[model samples]
Target: MLFLTRDLFSKKLTILFLIILGTYGCKTKTSSEQTAEQAPALVKSPEFNADSAYQFVQKQVDFGPRVPNTAPHKACGNYLVSTLKKYGFSVVEQTFKDTTFDGTIINGRNIIGSFNTANAKRILLTSHWDSRPFSDQDSLVKNKPVMGANDGASGVGILLEIARVLSLQATKPDIGVDIIFFDVEDWGATEQDTSMLHSGFCLGSQYWAANKHIPNYTAYFGVLLDMVGAKGATFLKEGYSMQMAEDVVREVWTTASRIGYNNYFIDERGGSITDDHVPVNTVAHIPMIDIIHTKNSVVRTFFDQWHTADDTMEHIDPKTLKAVGQTLVQVLYQESANLAL
Candidate 1:
C-alpha cells in the first residue's frame, strides 16, 4: 500500500542519493567471519500444516472482501479475535478512527496476540487484514473491490497457522511472540486519483507504532508477510527490508536457502516497498523486514491476480505457504535454543 511519487528529475536525484548512501553506509563481512559466527546448526522446526493455512485463507475470502465500513470486515475482525482467544494467547484489540487520503473517516482495528507474555525478549509478526477497496489496477473491473486472497488473507493465514502450532507445543520459547493483524491498510487512494497524500496507506500500523499496546514496548526484531501465497512466488530481498534490517533479512534468506528453498527466497535486491514494516521501523524503532512477493515484469509488479476480482482460492498454493511457514518456524526455534544456552 506504499506509494512513491517523483518527477523524472527527482527520480534521478533520488537514485544519486541512494548510491551515495549505499557507498558510505553499506559494508559487508567476509564469508569466513560470518560462517564462523553463525555455525551450521540444524534446528528442527514445528510441522507447518499447509492445509490448515489454506483453509484459513479460504475462510476469510468466503466472508467477501473485507473492506472497511462493510459487514464482512466487522465479521472477519470478530472471528480473528475469537480464534486467537481460543488458541490460548493473550489478545489485545486496539481500535481507533483514521482519516484516509480523500478525507474519509474509517474505523481501524489492530489485533495483537501475545505468546509467552511474561517474557521480555520478543519477535513481532504481522500482516494486513483489510482488502483493497478499489481494483484500480484491473483493466476491466477497475471500479470493483479486490477479494485480496493473496494480498490480505494469505499473510494472516500463515500467521494463524503459526499460532496454531505454537499453541500445541509443550515447551514454549523463552521469548514472547506477537502476531499482529493490521486493519485499514488497503484503503488508500488509487493510482488514478491525483491526491498527493503519502499517509493514506498503512493506517493501522502507523497507529500501533505511535501507541503501542504495551507501554514503551520493544522487540528484538519483527517479520512481516504480504502477498505470500501466490503460485511460484519469489521473495527477493526487498530494498526497504535491506535498508531497515539487513541482519534480520540475511538471517531469513540464509535460513531459507539452507532449508532448500533458495528457488523461492532469492538472494537479490527487489524494489523498495512502503508496506506496514516501514512505519514500525521508522516510528517504533523496531528492526523489521518484509517477506513479500515481487515480480520482474511490466505487466504486473505483483502477482497475476493482484488487485483483481480473480484473486480467489485457486491462486492459493500450499507449497508456497509451507516454504514461508517452515522457514519462520526454524528461525524461531533456533533463536529460542540460542537463548536457552
Candidate 2:
C-alpha cells in the first residue's frame, strides 16, 4: 500500500459517505480487571497463540516470495486454500485477470473463507497475500522480489490462527467471520510515479469490491491488517478509517488498550493510505479500517524493511503478532456476545 501524500490526497477519488451503525456497547475489561458491573455474562475471549501464528508466518516465508504467477505463489495459494478447508471454512476462490501498471497481464485470485455463514451479522477481516514482484525501494536489489514476512504473511498468519482457534471452540461467535486474502495488490508502479499511484495499486481489492464472491454480501464492519509482526510496531488511526468508520476504530483501539496493547495501537492519526480497505469501503460500501504499522520517523512511514529484500523472518516478532491477534479475538468475541457498541 502507498502512503497518501498531500498531492495524492488532493487527487484522490471522493469516498462515498458511509452510513455508520451503532450496535455494540461494553466497558473495557481485562483478564484481571473484571468488575461486578462488567462481570455479568461477558465471555472472556481466548488467548491468541503467538507461537502458532509465528509458525504460520514462517511456513509462508519457507515458500520464498509469493509473487503472483510464480511457482511459489501457486503452491502457497493452494496451501492457504487447504488450510482454510481444514479449519472447516466455506472457501471461495474468485479468479480474475488484470493488467498491471507495466502492462503485464496477471492472473489474480481473491481467496475468501467464511465461518458461521448462517448468521446475518458478519465481520470482515482481510489482508493482501501477494508479494511485490520487484523491490523498487531497495537500492541493492531493485529487481528482486520482497519476502514480505511482515507485510503480507503476518496478517494472514494471524487470521489463520484465528480460524484454527474458532474451529476448536465449542461456542462459536454469534456473528459470522469472513477472512479474505487479496492477491495482486503489490504489483503496481513505484513510489516515484505519482500519476499511477492510486490507480495502479489495490487491483485485487478493487475487483473483489466490485464483484463479490457472494451476491449482495455485506458486513457490520471490517478490519484490514498489514505489516503487523515487526518488533515495536505502532498502529496509528488511519485517515480514511477515521473518515469512514471512526466508531469502529474507537472500538478496536479501545479494546487493544484494555488488553494491555496500548503501546502498539497508538492514539494518533496517520496519513491516508491507498490500500485494500479503500476499495472495500468505497466500492463495496463496507466500512473497514486498516491496522497497519505507521510512524513519524524520518526514514519511512512503515517498517524499516518495507518493500525491501530484508523483509524476512528475522524482522518478525511473535509478541507483535500476539498483540494484534489477541486484540482481534477479543473484539470478535465481544461482538459475538451481543455487546452494545
What TM value does model 1 have?
Answer: 0.88
Q: Report, for every candidate in turn, its global Cα lDDT versus the true structure.
A: 0.89, 0.90
Question: Candidate 2 at 254: error in angstroms?
Answer: 0.1
Question: What TM-scores do the predictions have?
Answer: 0.88, 0.87
lDDT per residue (tens digit) for residues 205-263 in model 2: 99999999999999999999999999999999999999999989988887888778999
Per residue, candidate 1 scores C-alpha lDDT tens digits across 34-132 of: 754676586677798999999999999999999988999999999999888888989999999988877888989899999999898899999999999
Best by lDDT: 2
RMSD of each: 12.2, 13.6
